[model samples]
Target chain A: MSAERQGAASAAPDPRISMRGIVKRFGSVEALRGVDLDLHAGECLGLVGDNAAGKSTLTKILSGAYVPDGGEIRVNGRRVDFRNPADARVHRIEMVYQDLSLCDTIDVAGNLFLGREPMRGAFLDRRAMRDGARAMLDRLEIKIPRLDALVAQLSGGQRQAIAICRAAAFDPEVLIMDEPTSALAVAEVEAVLALINRVKASGVSVVLITHRLQDLFRVCDRIAVMYEGVKVAERRTAETDLQDLVSLIVGEKHVSKAAGAAAGPGGAA
Target chain B: MTAYTSRPAGSRLADMLATHAQLLSIAGFFLIMVVIFSVMSPVFLTTGNLLNVLRQAAPILIVAVAMTFVITTGGIDLSVGSTVALINALAAILIQFGIPWQAVVPALLLIGSAVGAAQGWFIAYQGIQPFIVTLAGLSALRGIALLMTEGFSVPIPGGIGFVQIGRGWFAGVPAPAWIAVVAAVAGFLALTGMRFGRYVTAIGANQEAARRAGIPTRRILLSVYVLTGLASAVAGIVIAARLGSGSSNAAVGLELDVIAAVVLGGTSLMGGRGSILGTILGALTIAVIGNGLILAHVSPFFTQIVAGAIILLAVWLNARVFSRLAAGTRRRT
Candidate 1:
């Protein structure tokens, strides 16, 4: 997964969530090999890697979007297992994928709850849902005129905000976002970065997976890099340079020794 | 900004016009025909003729209601026509074997639902293309109907229970017309008020998203198909009652008419955007067009050609109106 997920490995730094020895395979391709990860309270962990570097696979496992082949997961130092996204939701874990997973034809309220729509009698309680959706949007400072306006009518940034609002409305303890701003315009990307900061300030731990190094340096408190299926290095934003991170991600053996030696002190990446 | 963001006055008028465009256009067409027919013939606008039109529209409306569901799911059941034929054949065979009409009603309904479920399972679970499965069904079910009836019509016996279902009436309205009203109301309720309706729309909008959202996509798909079958069976019974007989050839080529009504009513063939109100309007439009054509003394062959052309035109217009509505705004960055 992302290097930011790896931290103070052997010392056990009071992690809110941790995964140990996670192994996953898709046919003959080993996507993850004995991976370890941890997330602390209210910390934004920025995970970076090249294409097919297992960043997505790890996020999927943590969010209960996929089942890991072998691993034990711990929440607040207590062991737990998740069989589905709903199961993870019980533990206050939610994921907002890059696609946003919002139904384009439905309005914000409908997309917010989706399959979990609130109903009164035989019909959907549109007023109640709309009110709740509006409240969530207001808190996020994203204004759309009508709760009934379809997502297809919204801008890319606005849709991303709605998605984060949805995950936040559910009151998840940990929120994972996959490449939240990869396809956005410059302004839209800035809006999403601001939303991420707002989400972190609200005391919800955020795991951001992205390939954009600039975004990592901009918003991430801790940076993690993954090479192939293994996390190569993890460093605090203050301690690591972009070139060293790039060297680890590209699997250059010349700098691997120095990078590995520094990361090993804290058993990170 | 509000004024600019809002629909134009002309577009607002257009929106209202477009909302009931199918009905308005169909009525306009009917009025022109009525004016011509009244000029040419004395008995063109008689009550008897109007009632006759109602009777003709009954079976088509029933079949079209089922088509509404199929089309709403971004799928079509080419087998509905065949299912109607099969139902008719089965009803006749059972009646001939001394089975009570009450029992036969349930049997036909069950058979219809089962056939629909089979098609739906293939579409939803097996990932088979709807066109192929229903097209295969169109052939298979008709063959079954032919096999059972041996390609012959079966005469209705006297004093059959629920024969009144086809021929009976409440107050002054025909029983079939009342049944059509009830079916339409039920369909409207199911589409707008129930959980099933929501799931159907979700599946139509994006099956993958709906599935990931934990919708019972497979089950709902099965139900939609089975519902269509049930509708077909109901139409079959009404047809059999109206004719006082059943034949393997009953409801032949009816699928095209039902689909035409659905598309004309503004139900997107692409799914995720259909309404019972629209379907009702669409079905009425088709009935009016067909009735008006005959009243105007048009040749039956020309009527068929004109009807097909009108359906295509209505759908094309519906697409333009909707796309305009969907593309109403541009961001002001």
Candidate 2:
């Protein structure tokens, strides 16, 4: 909450990432069509939409999982093209995939340091890795009793947390998470929202995609609603309640006036 | 807020046990086999007989170590036996032509790598299923071997230093056994303490995820097959050196034994999990059974039956007993 207040007080903070007219196609289906978004430093942007609304696709493009057929991406006012995930990573952009992207049979420490393991000459520095993992988990306030436990043994929320921590630990200027809390329990969801606040406080821009509309109010400074590959509305969290977002996500014409009004009070909290 | 207390201290011990449940079960089975064989046959525990068993089991052990890496990556090299046969025949042909054994040794290894790289190209870069590709290699490679040797055994002349590689002893252990030991130790170190092993495990667990994590997954996949090919070449050379002759018919059906040994060692055929120590025990167990049956005056054919039954039972124990134990402990906590 303090981070959001500070972000608002700043005078027109420069966007850490800017995407203009981003377009992507998947053989005949246009997954993303002419979408524009700007993510400022120290802000969380909540992306919400119904199924097939292009939320995942857009974020994937941003994270370099998909190549945009048309449009430009700017990081810190410099135009850049990401040919692959590695390219985005060079610019300190990280993403927690919807699938989690964790090797189930690998230990928690191993998963966190998957491709870029700490090595001593030709061998993996396992002791250093375990120690680094312990420190990383502690810094995130994530509690898992054993670092060597295989990811398959961990619960869904713990796995999600590990994935998020993996991305966040990279000291990314921008972090994108797709449906991070969709499968989490109530306490886990709260923990994730709190983690987002912490990240924002450190001046990292976060793009969060979720179906849970109410979660945006908890951590997001701004919300962007998408419908069928197009961004329909962008609202400041303090200015617009969840009712506006719900209508915006559903596309205004689809919702009756009664439902919009009915949703108002519940959406405010 | 639930403070997320660490599971009780006892569970730490339980966790360690559960993680190694497959290995421990296999080890127990290996010990039981050793005991049963020792009791049934008086000569089974003799040092000379044991040395012979070690010498004979060396080739299979070496290749099984490589296959552990392959299987851990969710791939199989069915062509390994055929590769061994090809190298076996090729080495004899070269030695018959008066090529020095030292030169031929490295040459055969390179040939093995080339063959593996070719197959790996198809499986890795060409997007073919490893099973289908290696199955094709099994037939083609054996065919090549038969054609080269003309269905005849080629004799390696005596008094050559090449024989020492297979028959000589080092510190009272057979050369081949020493070689197998070296390969196993190297494999253990690489798989347990290296990044390559981690990537292989990751690739097996989830290929796309590994790729997204910036790992060159296809290269790693291709390299594992190369290891198998190289190991097969070593095995082929040892077989030729020991017998002082090479034939295309050598090592026929050997792939099955190697696969069985690896699986019996608790490495999952589905991939993402493996153990070199288990593979070592598994290979020795199979070797012991074959040797023990001959010493016990049992029918040679029954050895196969016993070995097959034991493999099936060990795998069942791993999948059923160990998993259930792990699950039961989880439920209690």
Top TM-score hit: 2
lDDT of 2 by residue, A181-267 (tens): 877778888888888999999988899988777788889888888889998877788889866676777766867763555464433
Candidate 1: how large is its RMSD?
5.6
Tell me each candidate's i-RMS in Å.
6.7, 3.4
Mind giving the per-residue lDDT tens digits that candidate 2 earns over B1-333? 632223333477677777777788888888888899899988999999999999999999999999999999999999999999999999999999999999999999999988989999999999999999999999999999999999999999989999999889999999999999999999999999898989999998998888878888889999999999999999999999999999999999889989989988888788898899999998998898888888988888787887778778878886788657755554211
**Residue-level lDDT for A63 in candidate 2:** 83
- What is candidate 2's TM-score against the reference? 0.93
lDDT of 1 at A212: 66
Candidate 1 residue-wise lDDT, A1-269, digit = tens: 43444443324456888888888899999998877887877778888776788898998888777889998899888888877676777788888876777767566788787777788898878887888888877776666666766666566767777777787777778989888876666766676787778878777788998766667777777877776788777778778776677676767765656555433432222
Error of 1 at A229 (Å): 3.3
Instruction: Please give the distance, in angstroms, between residue A103's alpha carbon in candidate 1 and its true position after superposition.
Output: 2.0
